[model samples]
Target: MDGLQAYGAGKAGGAFDPVTFFQQPHAILRIINWLFSVVIFGCIANEGYINRPTEEQEYCIFNQNANACNYAVFMGCVCFLCCSGLLALDVRFPQISGVKDRKKAVLADLGVSAFWAFMWFVGFCFLANQWQASKPEDNPLKEGGDAARAAITFSFFSIFSWGAQSFLAFQRYKLGADTAIFGDYADPGQEADQGPYSAFPGETVESPPAGGVDGTAGSPVGYQRQEY
Candidate 1:
């Protein structure tokens, strides 16, 4: 039963272990996701805008498409925040005693991870397309080319990392479901009620007849005739 306990069903107030926590596959992926989001948003925020000598206003470097740059930056920021929140939740997960609560948490993780993964995919494609279509004349100096490429690369990596998180969450959900089902079926109260050798209720064993061998209240017929 110890081996079969559902994830996040551990006793509360356990001591935290940083080494073990970071060693987990899911934790490692989360850290990677966090880093990727930082790289994407950091690059775009700092170097995504450029100003032409002729124009007074700054413009987005991705083909001058503000939407492209905005989309990537927005998604990246959201991912970074979400990763931080999820990491905190992961740290507290094992202390959750309620199965339903744990389930809700895992489901939230799954949905969020999946949603972010899709968003990153979209952002990567949008940014890359805009970059590819950019005219050399727009920025002849190529000031933010490296930054734009870095953002796009990290966005692409983020898609896979978030997808992996979703997969891990799904696995945890399934494991918990299986453990709950088996636990219900193995309940001691149910087993006691259905004991193998127990008789049905209200049934009684029959007693032998009170009188003679012929099953009558009087003496045997042969013995009575001899006395007479």
Candidate 2:
């Protein structure tokens, strides 16, 4: 079955729909992140070249802060690819069957999500702070000022986008934690056993007979009682 049926994601048809795809929060965030990545990458890349002066020094040399902005662009590209891969995975394998494996996946997602959030926050701050701090003596008219500002603005947007993803991952982690504590979350690959709770709909424990084989009280007729 497809992911929608496998995971019971929705009641609609299992077939893919563009409108439904964009409706989900995770998918929305992924698309937004992807767009932000592209925008930031373009701005930073453009700024790096556009701001370069024709004089003795290059653009980066003219604006030392541009280096940090370039690094942000690199990270944006990486985040973009990561977002794409995650989106594809979500669409293809929406639900993981095994409990243990699912928990591991959730934890990994949480870690990666948090890492990206921190990276984006720090990157945005670093770029913005560096840009604002640097005061160049040469006041070039077309020093990619607009591109740099756009990159910084989109960098901020990316921070929130990644933060939202991280928050969602954390919520998933919390749900997994609750399931581990009180529910029957088991790995299908492992041998099944009676967990801490009884089977659903209730179960009954069979009681042995009161009489014993030796005419003693409280012993069953299955075998001789141990003296130890």
lDDT of 1 by residue, 136-155 (tens): 99997788899999999988
Clashing pairs in 1: none
Off by over 4 Å in 2: 1-19, 51-57, 136-139, 185-228
Query: Stretches of candidate 1 above 4 Å error?
Result: 1-4, 187-228
Q: What would the per-residue lDDT of candidate 2 be over residues 98-197, giving only the tens digit for each residue?
A: 5555556656666777788888888778877877776655445556677777777888888788888878877776765665554555555332343344
* Residue 114 CA displacement from its true place in model 2, Å: 1.0
lDDT of each: 0.84, 0.67
Which ten residues in a row are the worst by lDDT in model 2? 1-10
lDDT: worst 10-residue window of model 1: 201-210
